[model samples]
Target: MNNKLSLKNINVKYGESLALKSINLDIYKGEFVVLLGSSGAGKSTLLRTINQLNPLTSGELDFFDLGKIRNKKDLQNLRKKTGMIFQQHQLIERNTVFQNVLTGRLGFHSLLRSILPLPKFDQELALDCIDRVNLLDKALVKVKELSGGQQQRVGIARALAQNPSLILADEPIASLDPKTSHQVLSMLKDICKKDNISALTSLHQVDFAKEYGDRIIGLSHGKIVFNGKSDQLSDEILKNIYSSSTITEETNFTSNEVVMV
Candidate 1:
């Protein structure tokens, strides 16, 4: 349970508004952690900051033994170790599944090497990644031809091809149906366990976070409101994390019942 990533008193701001408060987090290797909160709780912001996609305004952020990566070169190397999966499934619609997965090799290849088609070994690696996601049969199919769930699986394959030590997923299952969401998340959990890689996923659903995460960190108003084992989250903690007005508007619904006179 060695720490793979550590954030100490991290803070982020955009102009006058603060995006993240003094947040401290430690992610151990081979652990599955979930950041849970309503929208705008800084879950996405925190994830981006880990990869240095969003710069920290204050405090220390460290990834493994890479040291403090302040320059572009160091940041680029950090990104190689941290792979990101977005909700949109950010694949090139025109590219074949194999081609999309091959893009993950860019971090390992030279600029000139990546400009051309991937090398034979890289191609085999991409295919292996596809097999890991159970999508080897769709390797030749265009990205646009796949369903939403299939596309997200392809995204996972792409991350696998990167040979990442840590994977960050930003609401990866947000766009899928409930059944598909469960399927994709289950696969993601399996992949993380199988690869022995650490994973941090941001999720809007408390139930999914409880089910899939070994640990859950709840954010509220840009601060870490709760951090503990998934089984430890209480109803009171959930209410506090989701107390915003938006949550009431989005999650409040009741099924209609028929009345016979």
Candidate 2:
């Protein structure tokens, strides 16, 4: 299978903190990989690096046709090839869902074209993306007026608008309730499958990870403790992935602080 992404000797640092330590990984096309770790195991940092949002102290990333990062222009285009879903649904709350989804196409247009109203076909495309997330009816609604779950769905639509081959979701369902979390993740996986988009989603909910992911990577203090099929992530393996020195499986699920756990 074609690799969706590949990293070799990857390392990231923020001042004195070592966020990633010589991490290496390869994700195959159309596969869903779940990233799990305690509060500081570097899940978010790794995702940020994939999009060139976080500076890598040392590493080489190969994102298929996007190529290696050598300059600002290269990184900018690389971002266009990938979509990111953040914990906070980072939307223009005041804008209607259609406008927000249209933002995904900005990378494909010039600054002037981006700021101006999108063409009719673009509007129809945005509506189609919204419909994929089951929010077609809410397309005209102002984003701020929507529920938290709906807002997150809009984020997914915006990412879809990018027409990205790979989607990196950082705690996409963290803020949602258990039932809603399942709904959101199921929708995410289903869309990726139908669209043939590969996804690397960070999640704390172990059961959800198993149910939704084709593979799992468990991290601890910027290092991978396990990288295998989700079924291989036994309770004992989970315990190792979230050791007390990092994050234990017993860590509070409600707290983002359990990032490494």
lDDT of each: 0.86, 0.85
| Candidate number with greatest lDDT | 1
Off by over 4 Å in 2: 244-261
- Candidate 2 has an lDDT of 0.85
Give, for candidate 1, the lowest lDDT window spanning 10 residues: 252-261
lDDT of 2 by residue, 1-261 (tens): 345688889999899888899899998778899998767778999899888789889989887766677888888888887888988999999999998999988888889888888888778888899999999999899999998899999999999988888999999998888777878898989989898888999998787888888999999889988999977877678777777354555655434333443
lDDT of 2 at 257: 37
How far out, in Å, is residue 199 in model 2? 0.6
Count residue pairs with overlapping backbones in model 1: 0
lDDT of 2 at 151: 92
